[model samples]
Target: MATVNLDLTPIHQCSADGCTFNASASCHAPAITVGDHGANHCATFLGIPTKHSPTNDGHVGACQLSDCSHNADLTCTASTIEVGTSAGGGTECLTYSAA
Candidate 1:
């Protein structure tokens, strides 16, 4: 397997305890995707047991919300973002804003 490095926006906080990449309220995934299925939700969120490597820092690698102000060419340009449980029973990016 090959790893691709990118200058991505960091995930400042994540309150989704059910997520595998959440560690102590912080995201530990190497990268996360937002706006999956054409919705402003965290597509990378997995409600599975067991956690990933804590040493891995989480970043917003991609975003599908083209209307979001923080989205630039399908990539998140926010300085930082927060992930949390949404009202519809899905994880979402709380930092999402209209352009």
Candidate 2:
């Protein structure tokens, strides 16, 4: 199988203990998608047991919230970001701001 390499740049700080990709306050996922289904939330978030402290840090691969000020060309331009729970459910980008 061919492995695809992602050259992610945006920094994503994941603080959700329930996320399988969170490791030592950092995100370990190869890439993470921000903005929920028609809402501001972390859609890539997955709840699982046995959290492993992965060495790789998470990157904001994409942002669907077109109204967010940090979004540019469908990508997140924030220098830093965080993932946390919201009233909707799961994780949401704490740094999200209106344009």
Candidate 3:
């Protein structure tokens, strides 16, 4: 038998408690995407009450912001990331920084 290892970046902390994937100040979506038309918003953030996750450990599966320093090949290379409400009044990747 063979084993595979995935080095996806984990979400450190998420303040979007209203999201279905959020629990205990963490994200449990398994994987999240960071990018909303070049912005640092979290595209995976959903406020609906369906499909809730049981775990609190989520990872960054993909990031569409190529201008971010932590993004590489559409993937987030940061060791961990934080998500929270943005100044524009939307869920965003708080760890985002211009390259």
Candidate 4:
């Protein structure tokens, strides 16, 4: 399958409003990954967002959110998304949406 680099420069907020990593300007995490639906959780599987590009169909690997309700498919299904710093020290998403 062909790979397409996802532009993480668009996100500017974290879905988890209580997260400390979320700043008023941008995400505090060093890196982030696009969720199957939107952006809702840090990509810590490897402690960082994978370098793989998104597919044309918009499906990626398993999501990294440990507390997500739809974590079964490793995908997100929220209306909006949130950004924040990973558990370590990088930019990440705290919420996502399929819409």
Candidate 5:
């Protein structure tokens, strides 16, 4: 049988601070998106205080911040997902799975 490895580090240490979805080291958003090195910000990011074009899927994916323990296999057991801001004002999903 093929084995899958999952990394739950990135999700545990989200890099977004200005996002309203972030709280006490946990994300509370529904979803998030990412952009290129110089793309616009996500519309769902609460309290962003800015508007820009949507980013491409290539640079977008589920946020892994907060209590998220998603593995490298891209498997998430979180009942809900949170959206946060990236380093370059991009969007990211902060998914978490139950321990």
Candidate 6:
């Protein structure tokens, strides 16, 4: 039996079609990092053409959005985060909000 530890994992929903970690519109990386890489994006993003897919769910590992309320010491404090390109392009944390 597998014990679910909520504290050890962070729910991260990604909707980047070209991302290698994106599987069925969800991120399959074990962990993801959000930062200002050409505008707050999923630093873990890898184009599908550049690699294969993952077999696991993604969790928010770190966040560099200092203006966001979920950012605590460069880490994401949110229990869950959404990643999308609608926020002015690129893979950005849709859940990012003003502090």
Candidate that would win on lDDT:
1
Largest TM-score belongs to which candidate? 1
Q: Candidate 4, which ten residues in sequence have the lowest lDDT sum?
A: 51-60
Candidate rank order under lDDT:
1, 3, 2, 6, 4, 5
Give the alpha-carbon lDDT of every model.
Answer: 0.88, 0.77, 0.86, 0.43, 0.40, 0.73
> What is every candidate's alpha-carbon RMSD to the true fold?
1.8, 2.7, 3.2, 9.6, 11.9, 3.6
Model 3 RMSD to the real structure?
3.2
lDDT of 4: 0.43
Task: Report the lDDT of model 1 for residue 25.
Answer: 97
> Which one wins by lDDT: 2 or 6?
2
TM-score to true structure, per model: 0.90, 0.82, 0.88, 0.32, 0.31, 0.78
Model 1: number of backbone collisions: 0
lDDT of 2 by residue, 1-99 (tens): 223245454445666878888777788776778877668877888888877567556788889999999899878887778888776665888898999
> Comparing 1 and 5 by lDDT, which wins?
1
Model 4 stretches with alpha carbons more than 4 Å out: 1-41, 44-62, 86-90, 96-99
Give the CA lDDT, 0 to 100, for residue 10 in model 4: 35
Candidate 1, 1-99: lDDT as tens digits: 335365789899999999998999999888889997779899899888988768756899889999899999998888899999988878999999999
Over the stretch 1-99, how does candidate 6's per-residue lDDT look in tens digits?
223334533655677888887877777777777886425777888875754555656787777778888888877777788888874667788888888
What is the overall TM-score of model 1 with all chains considered together? Answer: 0.90
Candidate 1 stretches greater than 4 Å from native: 1-6
The CA lDDT at 38 in model 4 is 45
47 Cα displacement, candidate 2 (Å): 0.4
Report the lDDT tens digits of candidate 4 across residue range 1-99.
445334323343444334343444334434445543444435432333333332232222345554666454544444335455566654555454232
Between prediction 1 and prediction 5, which has the larger TM-score?
A: 1
Question: Residue 31 error for model 2, in Å?
Answer: 0.8
